[model samples]
Structures are given as C-alpha cells and as structure tokens.
Target chain A: MEHEEAKKTTFWANIGNFFKKIGSKISEKAAKKAGSSNKTQMLEWKKDGWKATVCLAPALIILAVFTFYPILNTFLVSFFPDYNYVTDEFGSFGFDSYALVLQDATFWRAMGNTALMVIVSVPLSILIALIITVLLNSIKKLQGFFQIIFFLPYVTNGIAFGLVFATIFSPMDYGLVNTLLNAVGISSVGWTGTTNIPYWAGLFVITVYAIWNGLAFKILVFLSGIQGIDKQYYQAAQVDATPRWRVFTKITVPLLSPMILYITITSMMGAFKSYSSVVSLFGESMGNGQNETFITAVGYIYKYFNRVVHDNISWVLSRASAAAVILFLFILAITGIQMWANKKKVHY
Target chain B: MEKELYFASDEQAKKYERIRKVRLFFVYFFLTICALFTLIPFYWMLATSFKTAEEVQRIPATFIPLQPTFQNYINVFSGENAILLRYIGNTVLVGILTTIFEVIITILASFAFSRLEFKGRDVIFALLLTTMMVPGEMMIMTNFTTIARLGWLDTYQALVIPFVASVFYIFFLRQNFKQIPDELYYAAKVDGNSDFKYLWKVMLPIARPSIITITILAMIGSWNAYLWPRSVCVEADMKLVTDGLMYLFQNEVGGTSDHQIMAATTVVSLPLLIAFACFKKHIMRGVARSGIKG
Candidate 1:
C-alpha cells in the first residue's frame, strides 16, 4: 500500500513540473515580443558590436568635420595652383605654390617680421611677468588688491583694449598721444601710420600690454608653485645660513622649470597670433604702407582672405595658403626646439 | 628661538629690526611703482573719458580732466551708438549658449572617457591633443568657408557653432572625472541604471568644481571673442562690443573727438571689468586649476 502511494505522488509532481516549464517559456517569449518594437532595442539586445558603432557615430562625425577635413583641405589647397575658387577646377598641382611662396620677397619679410616679434616680445613678456610674479608672491598686505590690478589685462577684452590703444596712438594731431607729443618739443610721430616709428611703437605698446596682462596668471601660477615647496627646506636652509638669493636660485627656479616652459610656449604662440590689436591699430591695410606693415604671415593671411571674400583678390588666396603652410612649419620647428630644450630641464 | 637666532645680542636684534623696517619700506616703494605702471593706463582711460575734446588734447595732458563731463558717456548710451547694446546682447547670448551646450557635451564625453572601457579611447584622446597644435589661424580659412557654406555668414551661428566642442575642455573634465571613485559607476550599473542617468545623477555633482571652471572659461572665451565674431558677423546689426568699438574707433562718430572714443571704450569694457571684479575669486580659482597643468 505504501509503495503505491509514493508512486502516485511522483506521478503528480512530474505533471506539475511539465506545466511550469511551458508557462515560463510562454512568459519569456511574450517579454521578448514586447521588447522587439524598436530596432535599437532589438540590436542592443542582440548585436553588441552594432550598438557600439552606432553610439560612436556622433563623435566620429565631429572628428571628421573638424579635424580630418580641415587638415586635408589645407594640404590639398597647398598643392593646387591659383584657381578660381568659384569655378572649382583642379588646377595644375606641383611646387608652384611653394615656389611662389618661397620666391616672394614680401613673404620672407613677413616671416622676418613675425620672427622678430616672437623673438623680441615673448622673452620680454615672460621675464617681466616672472619678476612681477616674484614681487607679488613676496608681498603680504593688500595682496588681493595688487593681484586684481596686475590681472586686469588678462580679463580686459583684447579688442576693446586695442581700440583704446588705437585712439591714444592715432597719428592725427587731434589724437591724444600725438597731441601730447606735440605739446612737448617733439613732432608728431605716426605711431601706427609710418614704418620708421609705428612698427616699433606698436611693438612696444603691444608688448607692454601683453606683459601686464600676462603678469597676474603667471604670478598666481608661480605663487602656487612657491607655496607647494616644502617650507622645511627653507627652514633647514636658514639654519645652514644659506643666502636668500642662493636658496631661491637652487630651490625655486628648478622647481618652476615646467611652468616656465609652458609660459614660454604660450607666449610664443601669443606673439605669433597677435592680430586683434594689430588690426585695430593698423586698420585694414595693417600699417604696412599698402602691404608693408600688413605683411606679417598672419596679418597677410587675414588681409588676403578678407580681400578675397569682399574685394575679389582671389589670386591672393594661393599666396595666403602658401604663407599659412610656411607659418605652420615655422611654429612647429620653433616649438619643437623649445620643447627639446626644456625637456631636459623638467625635474622628473 | 627664531628671534634669538637672528641676533646673538639684544642690541644687534634692535638694529636688525630697524633695518628690516627700512627694507619693508623699499619693497613697498618698488611695488608701488610697479602698481602705478599697471594702473595708469586704466586711470588715463577714465580720465580721458571725462575730459572735453580740447581738454583731452591739451598740452602736457590733463592728468585729471579739468572740466569733467558726462557728455561722452551720454553719447555712448544714445541711439547713434545703438550697435553697442546689440553687441552686448549678442556676446551674452553666445557666451551663455556655448557654455550650456559645451558643459553638457563635455560632461557626457568626459564620463565616457573616464569610466568606460572602450577600445581605442586613449588613441582617440591622443589624436584630439594633437589637434591643439593646429592653431586657430591654420583653420580660419576652412572655418570661414564652412560657415559661409552653412549660410551662417553674418549670423551668430557662425560665431558659436564651430567652438561648441572643445577638445581641451573634454580632456580637462575627463582628467577630473577619472579621479572619482569607481564604486559609484558600478553601483549605478548594478541597479540597472543607464549610463546617462549614472552621469547625470552621480558623476556631475561630484565634478562641480571642474564644471564651474570650464563654464567660466567657455563663457569668457565666447564673451571676449573678437576675430571670429568680426569674421562672421560683418553686418552692422550682428556686430559685438569688440567690433562695435572697432567701428567707433574707425569712424570716430561720437562727436569727432578723442574723448568720445575713450568714453565709448570705457563703456564697452566697464561691464566685463566689473563682472570680472565681482567674480574675481571664482575666476582665480578656475585659472589656478588650469594653471596647475599649464
């Protein structure tokens, strides 16, 4: 009787298990059917590879438009001869643009101008900024006030600042600066008009502005670098009777080398791209006496394009393109040298 | 102990204290001169703005305008210079919009960069870093053409769109984001939350400082933008403060006088300068954060 009862229970359990498996399968199928409405949902559930590719589409498109296409266009334009941009013809490609760019005297002159500005202005600004920074770092009273004044230039709109400069330095006697000079025994100098003085004047004013502007940030950076130094070193040095200058030279300068390199590179770049103010001061002609002051690699490129678009100097585009390529190469070489030199100085 | 070490005797210490006082005086003297050099240009702009046309051009210069006037300031506010307000509005709108879009895009991209174990991520980031070398000047021609093709010339679209994605900001925010603990990301994952929700809820609030820094940077860059705005918005109505100031500088229309130009410049710059001063702490913090790497 017991054996027969146990057999009956096993038979009932088997029947229940079979029905439970079918019900679970039906629910699973129903859930899958509900999720299959959108192609995205279907792919995500099944095709992981396709999901990733679709996800990356926006970023990839941005890269192509902003990075790849522009670089490719720059290289392609350099190879093509002067063609009507409107006509969209593939003019003869050779070293014609390169040859013309290389042979042009004005191109070299502009290169010289740009190089001069970089060589002269960058170091001056960086050095002055360091001195101002060091001084600010040493001060204790009204520290915030001093910092704000020094940093004013950094936040000042370069274009608006340029306007102020242009007005103050305008060549006309009615202009404030020229008027002041005349008030003295000096004759009115064309600060942005004539080549002999205006270029140097422009350089001086712009450099001052750059240095003043550069002071606050670099000061703060150097201050942070200074603050980070283990004060124990100074305390120990004092016990050893180390001179103040010696300690600074040995400890601070080496520690700040990395930041110095950054400042140098940025300053060099800043000098190369000093256009907003230059344009404001020199007008559309760029104080180049019909192309003289206007001959900077950047200024020239700016002028040519502005002219091409507005005044129909399409021929200048090839020249401008050629100048731009050379300018890029110039920057690459200088920055490469700067980095190579500074790399050894970086303290681990 | 420090005081004793400076001088073995009280007499010596007394003399040293006097010398220290003298040194402090000299240091302040030098600092004052430096500060003067920095402040004088701004003072001159203000002083010149207050002077009459003849007073501004006066011999030996009126260090303080003898006859102070609000005439120039009035002219700047008047309708003859209506473009000034338009320029301000344009700049504010561009700055705010770019900051908003960029912050959102960058937060998402930075999160992806920080947490996700994606293929070729480092390589992609490395390529983006290389683009930093491609100076704005190198790409100006192409950017201009692109804007023209988009039929966005003389419009704010040309000024704002190309710069909406800053590789530098993405890289910066990514570095900040990576420093966050991984537990939060995984916790969200275990809860079956999407990546977007995880970022919006957990990651963004943690990265507030960096977000603020980038926002300040983007806004300032857009606000002070001169060349791009000039290139794109050639139409009079599309002009910004920088361009408007340039126009005023070119035409000298605010009374055919030097004082008027000075006043207009002062007016244009005053808003930015004041805003900068008010938010000086925030800006300095942002600058210091970036300067750490710079």
Candidate 2:
C-alpha cells in the first residue's frame, strides 16, 4: 500500500514541473519581443543623428564634383601628353608637360614679373596702410564721409578704374598725370611705355591701388583696436610723463600687431595671385614696352589655357594643369611661411 | 623773486597752449589732405562723367566740368548703352539670390559642424578648411569644365551653384555657433524638445550677428565679383555691371569714351556707396570682428 502512494506523488510532481517549464518558455518569448523593440528605438535615434549628414551630402558632392574632382583631374592631366579638352583625351601619365612648362621662358618671365610685383607691392601696401590708419585715427569730424572716400577705390569698377588710370598714365601729356606734371614744369615720362620704368611704375600703381583700396578697411580695423584699449593706459602713461613717441611705440605698435599680421598675409597672397589689374593694363600685346608687367602667375595660367583653346588645342589640359599645380604650390609655400610668421608674432 | 617765478609759469603755460593749438592745426590739415587724396579718384570719375567727350580729352583736364550735363547718365539709362539698368538688375538679383543660398547652406552646415557629434565630422570640417587654403585660381579651369558638363553655363545656376556653400563662411559660422553655452541644449533635452526645435529657438537667435555678417559679406562679394562673372556669363545679356563696363571698353565699341564709362561706373558703384552710408557702423563692426576672428 505504501509503494502505491509513493508512485502517485512522483507523477503529480512531474506534472507540476512540466507546467513550470511552459510558463518559463512564455516569459522568454515576451522578453525577446521587448529586446527587439528597444533595438528598433535605437535605430530610429541613429537615423535622427545621421540626418544632418544626409542633408549636407548633396552640397558636398556637388562641391567635390565641381571643385575637387576637376582639380584632381587637372593635376593628373598635367602629367600627361597633350590633353585635348574637346576630345576629353587626358593622354597618359608622364612629366613632359611639366618639362615644357619648366623650360618655357615666358612662364619663368611671368613668374619673375609676379614675384617682382609682390616683392615691391606687398610691403609698401602694409607700410602705407599702417601710416594711413594712424592718420585716419587722429581725425574726428566728418570721419564717416572721409572713411567712405578712402574706401572708394575698393568699390570702384576695377576695369573702368584701370582704364582711367591708363589714360592718366598715358605716355603723352594728353594723359591726366602727364598734363599735371607739365603744368607743374616737369617733363613727360613714359609712365606706361618704357620697359623698366613702366614695370616699376606698374608696381607703384598696383601698390598704390592696393593700399588705397585696403586703407579704409585697415583704418576701421585699427580704429577698433585702438578704441578697445582702456583709456586708463594712455592716461597712466601721460601721468608718468612718457614721451609721446614712447607711448606710440610702446603701446600702439604692439596693440596693432595682430591686425598688421592679418593684413600682411592677405595682401601678400593677393599680390602673388594678382592678375586682373595687370591684364587690364596690358591686354594682349604684353612684353612690349611696359607690357612685360602683364605676366602674373594667374595671368600666365589664363594665357596658356586661352592659347591652348585657340592654337595648340591639344596641350590645353596638360599645360593648364602644370601651371595650376605650380601656382598652387607657390601660393601654398608662401601662405605656410606667412602663417608660421603670423603665429610667432600674433601675441594675444 | 616769487612774483617773477609766477609770471614765468604763466608765460610757459601760454607758450604750451600755443604749441598745442599749432600742432592741432597741422594734424587737421594733414588729415584733410589725405582725405582729399583718397577721394580724388571718385571726384575725377564723377567730374569726367558729366563733361563732354572733348572735355575728358582736353589737356589740363578740367578739374570741374565747364558745362556739366546729364547726357552721359541719360545715355546710360536710355541710349544704346541703356543696358546699364539691366546690368544693375542682374547684379542685384544675383547678389540677393547668392546671399540667400549661401546663408542657408552655411547656416545648416555650421549647425551640423558645431552641434552634431557624429563619425568623421571633424575630419570633414578639416578637409573643407584645406580647400579654403587652396588658391581659387587652381580650381577655376576645372570648375569651368564641370559647369559645362552640367550644362549650367550662361545660367544663374553657373554663377550661384558652385559657390552656394563657402567653406570659409561655414568655418566662420561654425566658430560663432560653438561659442554658445551647452546648458541650453541640456535644458531643451530635459523638456523633450526635438533637436531641430532646440537649435531653431536657442542657437539661432544667439548667432544673429554672425548670420547678418555672413549675409553682408556674401552680398558684397557677389556684387563686386568680376572674374567669375566675366568667365561664366559669356553672353551680353547675362553680363553683370562689372562685365558690362567691359562692353564699354570693347574694341567694337568706342572702347574709351571717358565720360560715358565713368558715368556708368559712378552709377554702378552708387548702390554700394548708399548702402555703406546707411550702415557704416554695423559694417565696420562686422569687418573688425571678422578680422579679429579670422
């Protein structure tokens, strides 16, 4: 009778264990469902974060296709033989294009002319800008009107202004400048005709143009810098009976250094890449008289490309690519040097 | 002795006063001269514009036109050269549209760069800056071909599309946006506001100065733009004011009618001059701030 009772108890226990297993299985299924929902929410959050990139991609790709890709292709084509734009034939990779560019006298002459211009123009612009800024700061009444007048050169039509200046600097007394000189009992000078003189004159006019164009902005920046200085410092120096020269040298010079550095770098870069004014001055028949002043690196690039499209036709891509690469490296090296110098000088 | 000492002090004071007054006069005189020198080009252009063709070519060129007439201005507005008005319209339209597009692209890109934390974000920004450092001429040839392929030449798209997003402007706006406090973001998050709403309400208002600055810069840049317009707008009807002036110089044209071209130039430059007059302080401040930051 005892053995029969033990068998019945054992069967009931086994049945209870089976029910517990089924309950546990149901809970596990529910947990899996909950985990997947969490994952779905995480993915939605990810999409939210990536949304900006999605919006920016179209613009970036357009920029790259239009800007970056062409630049790379141009660089690549520079290494090849006679690239024809019409045929879209980027011949093959070789350094022949570079060799032609390096050997070309006009290319070197253009580079030299641009270098002479930058060497002459950049520092003069900086110095004159500083002087003008100092003088502009000292003025008080009708300051706004004067500032506008100073900034006028920058706003005037450069091409038209180039024409005006051309007329003024015209070799004969009919020119405005020569007429003025004759009125003042000075002999007429070939302001735009003599090779060396015109080259230097072009440099002078370009520098003056840059300086005058830059003056108003530079003055405004300098004025702001000066205004930012606590008046107390000047007052303190005055009380201590510091010499005016000392005060200017010790206070104003140091304070304006950062702005000076900025203007310097920009002006230097502008001078190196300058072409528009030079091109305007000497249209096509440059290398005659003062026409030699027309050969900026950028102008050279334009000339090479234009020459290719019209005459050579085959080497357009290769020649342009080589010129651009060289120009790019030249600008990059100058800018790098400038930036390094700026960092050393621009004390906070 | 005491009386003599007092008299001497008074005389010395008087002498110092005279010296100061003399110094002030010379300073003012020097400044006025510089100011006049600065303005002579405009004066010459304007004075030449109103003169007859003979007066422009006259030796001892008249400092002031003897018989100033509105003929040049009228010609530019009504004669065969009447496209001056169209040129102005084109400039304004291009300037306004370019500014709008640039502002939008720059603002959106700036937000992404400054606020968003994603993979490769910094790297992308650095790459953009690298492009900024490259000289602009390096890419012009390629950009020209790209536009040709896209068939965007002679269209406003060619003028406005390639430069719609400026890396320099983007970096500038991003720097401006970064200066905002992060607690604002936390507060918005606590309110369960979406990130877009948070940026729209909180960050944008704080970045108003930068937005305005970028807009002005874009406008001025587009307005003054020469080479790109001259390159892309090969057709006469599509020319900008700067390019239109080139027509005044074309050999087929008279090429050097001083009065008409100068008058047109003066007219072309009028809008910017007027704008500068109206907003000098803001522009100056914007320029100064940009120089410092840049």
lDDT of 1: 0.68
Over the full model, what C-alpha lDDT does candidate 2 score relative to the true structure?
0.68
Task: Give every collision pair in model 2.
Answer: none
User: Can you give the DockQ of every candidate in the order shown?
Assistant: 0.28, 0.25
Q: Please give the CA lDDT of all the candidate structures.
A: 0.68, 0.68
The sequence of per-residue lDDT tens digits that candidate 2 reaches over residues A162-233 is: 655555565655566778888989976655432434556666665666555656656666677776767676
lDDT string, candidate 1, A88-163, tens digits: 4558876687888788787777777777777877687667766666666666887678777777776777766665
Where model 1 places Cα greater than 4 Å from the true spot, the runs are: A1-60, A170-188, A193-199, B1-6, B251-256
Candidate 2 lDDT for residue A105: 84
Clashes of each: 3, 0
**Model 2, which residues run further than 4 Å from truth?**
A1-48, A139-145, A190-197, A230-233, A284-292, A308-314, A343-346, B1-16, B250-256
Residue lDDT tens for model 2, B1-294: 112222248778687668757876876777778788787777777887899877776777677889999999999999988987898899899989888888888888888877875555655765665565566667777776677667777898888888787776776788788899888888998999877887789888998988887787677777767777877777888988877776555331112476777777788888888877787766656666665563
Scored against the true structure, residue B101 in model 2 reaches a CA lDDT of 83
